[model samples]
Target: MSAINKVLFIAPRFHTNQIGIVKALLNEGVEVEFHVLIKGPTEDYAVLTPIKIEEGKFSRFLSKFLKTQKVNKYYAFPSFFEYFNTIKNFNADLIIIRDPGRFFSIVSTIIAKLLGIKICFYTQETLEIEAKNTFRYFFQKFYKTIFHAEWITPIGGTDTRIKKFLPFVVESRFDYLNETSAIEGYSSEKAVAVIGKFTARKRLIWALKLAQEFDCKIKIIGENTTKEHATVYQELLEYVEEHNLGDNVEFMCNLSHSRTLKELSCSNFFLLTARNEPASISVLESLSVGIPVICPLECGTSSYLTPEKTGYTYRQDDYDDLKNKFRRLLVHVSEDKKIRVECLNSSAENFSEQAYINKFNYIFKRE
Candidate 1:
């Protein structure tokens, strides 16, 4: 019989981004399956129906204890024999885990090895943020040793970023995939948009300042989801009032993904004031619409920025530098619709559905 040609994805939920990967695998005659913890509200992909797993009691106990110790919570722990039975029946050639938790990833890693199946894990953790304690350090070491699996992340410095914790893996093994889609072109209206949580780290206050000084129509997408966020949001509203920026800026909070897209379409440029952003989906989404962005260097998504095509990156937290860069980008935005289209096309080229499919094909074909 031919070699096994099935792939399985273990995730908390399947989002729109994963749909393309599934479709690509199906087009290539490879079977795709998803083992998810919960189904996403908008997960209506036709390629595969995800198998939802119930939480195990041991997993919950471990999760509570780990939380108290300041550790990552384990989200994927199904009944022992039932999980084993499911994997055995699927008999996938390759298995990919999304946001690998300590216990869940370790368990799945062992199961894959026993089944003689290749494993891949998606991670957003970067080495820049070091482990705070010995427990965390040892946990990472254990996971790395047991999994020894392929890591898929954004293209930037993910390889170097994970080096301090996972030094054994070769550079070639890193699969950088930031999924982006094609969108209709929109002309620059000299309006700017910012989308992110209203947390202190995101530096919305800086964006508020930009709106005050820059004198542009700025729209912020996000709501206060936490107590900390509510405090920040309140402060932002006060700043708008004190600075008389009420007319220039608007906070479009709690919007659905489709509505967010609609808001992006109505603007000319996107702005990111994050102090420590790790690969922002909002930045990629803005670029998908052909709207250029102005982000600080600390933002991981800035790696995708090409001064000649996409957008510019300023020094993090440097108000002067950010202002200067924003001024320059504003000039570009006012030029022609073709320039915007070109940037949008460039982003699509960098993170297209076909590119995502090709990467999976490479992984599946590898020895």
Candidate 2:
């Protein structure tokens, strides 16, 4: 074991949260670098150097074959040569592979081991619910073992959730580095917040229905990841215009984290329409800001929702169920003052930026 002075992060895409984490690491006096292996150029950040990965046809086919098509297509995938070359060039003390299930990660782990560099992988794959004998299930199990890293960081932040997907893993291997949020107090307004990327997976249409039916304001905040999603946003605007709901519907695109949290703090409740969300950082932020949430039971974060206490959970992708739940909640339930304080306390104790930094300072130490 030696001192960990430098670390390298390999990610598919570099978002705001990732940037924050890197800045925190830098503030701790660790030299941080990133290989953002996505297809396009990365936005310049002062804290870290982000290098874009160039993927060839063979790498793309292999990524698809490994059933990591979603991550590879949206973020970026590295070829074996790319991974080896990047690791060789950096000479970082530790390597953090953001997604363990990707084909390139398996190669990265092998290369890191050969170089005697400490490496760990962060995983968000929920494969326990997958049908047995399916290709995806097999691939997931296969990759889990092939990762062969020194540690595993499961994003679920629970033993049960991690076990459900990766049952064979040991407790010691679970490095629970959860995301963090800042709670800037709360204000109850007649508004519902819908936050996250403006992608098809978010199921924003369901949230829009609530705004259409209810009298309160609906705030949709997020950036479009693609042209198709931008068109979806446009169609949503058209729907609002046609229904003359412009006064109730407000679209705030690509807000900074602090600004988004400020908007979330004023809202009455946050809405989650994504049926199969692994876990939402926005939902955590909502809870941190003392705002309750209404999420589908299928969402990983739904486990945090306590009915009539913190928030509510409807059936997955059931608009009728969500509508009924919303109606009942709007009429019967308001964010209780005690519940708001409790929510803030729970989130701050568990998911604050300081807590995250403390965990990293301890765990990032080389063993």
Candidate 3:
């Protein structure tokens, strides 16, 4: 008998989460295929065997218009014809979509229903954000239409956002664990790391100001996503230069996932000042490396942070609160190494990679 060639994943981007899931499925002897529907080129990752759907200029224009009108235009377009052809060619038994908020998932679902294929929708964002308007309402209805699968998995702390809409399925998030045994305490010189695209929502400028106030060395890591954000990046650079914070603030652009892990391994703290974050994988990654994360309360991932334990959470947009937290951490660093160890232990216990993999396997096996 042939092995169960079980799952296919659809997404616009490939990141650590996708990489982890594919690795897990392969280890279980399950055949997996990735179908990406976007107008861009693809990156080469070792495990993600991606099937890229190239879009013409007209399709790209329409996709941009839909996104601007509302987030749900991703569902109403004709992008799924290509996706359906890809799925049919692959003969996949299970279809796993990364974010149902996109139009491709809506189209994929319709094709899956007609073909008698099971559909599993995975989202990392809150249902509230997904359904924030009328367009999203229609998108949710579209999701209900193709949600004929045995499970629905959401990775993060925002499960409550979707609990009311889809009550009869399994849910889970990415798990993190400290894999290394090198326990180095924070040095007399403080260090902070912020990992994410340099968008306005990431609040990189605020982090720079806070770094200057606390006399801490802050490393900003990520690429600029759009030309619109170029001004913000420039303004941040100007601020760092004007204040003579060249020594304290360092901007690192577009590091690979492995290189990012190495940076986090050496850092004393993780900094996330996102004005709005559905769920941050960066926080989980930080915790996995036993590095404490400091984030604003508005972030969905802040729900997992325990003050003075796993990390610190401050009120959103309050620069003073951030400064106070940094000040407290500075004091702790100077007075006690034991406090840092306690923080590391807490993060390791809660966010282990094994825990995440086991949960994913459970969801995949659900009837």
Which model scores highest in TM-score?
Answer: 3
lDDT (Cα, tens digit) per residue for candidate 2, span 3-42 = 8788887777664446556766677677888876553322
Report model 1's TM-score to 2 decimal places: 0.77
Single out the weakest 10-residue window by summed lDDT for candidate 1: 165-174
lDDT of 3 by residue, 1-367 (tens): 2234677777775555556557666676668887665422223386665766655456667755555644323534345566567678878777876666566666677788878787777655544465566676566555555565543433333343333212111112122223433254676454688887767778788888887776779998877656856777888899999999999988887677777766876677788888777667677667656677788776756656667776788887788888888777666545555644565554444444444445555545543
The lDDT of each candidate is 0.66, 0.64, 0.64
Q: Evaluate residue 325 in candidate 1 and report its C-alpha lDDT on the 0 to 100 scale.
A: 90
- Candidate 1, residues 38-90, lDDT tens digits: the string is 76444455657888877788877766655553222345477676777788899
316: Cα error in model 2, Å: 1.6
On a 0 to 1 TM-score scale, where does candidate 3 land against the true structure? 0.79
Ranking by TM-score: 3, 1, 2
Candidate 2 residue pairs that clash? none
Clashing pairs in 3: 74-103, 75-103, 155-173, 176-351, 176-352, 177-352
Collision count for each candidate, in order: 0, 0, 6
**Per the 3 Å backbone cut-off, how many clashing residue pairs does candidate 2 have?**
0
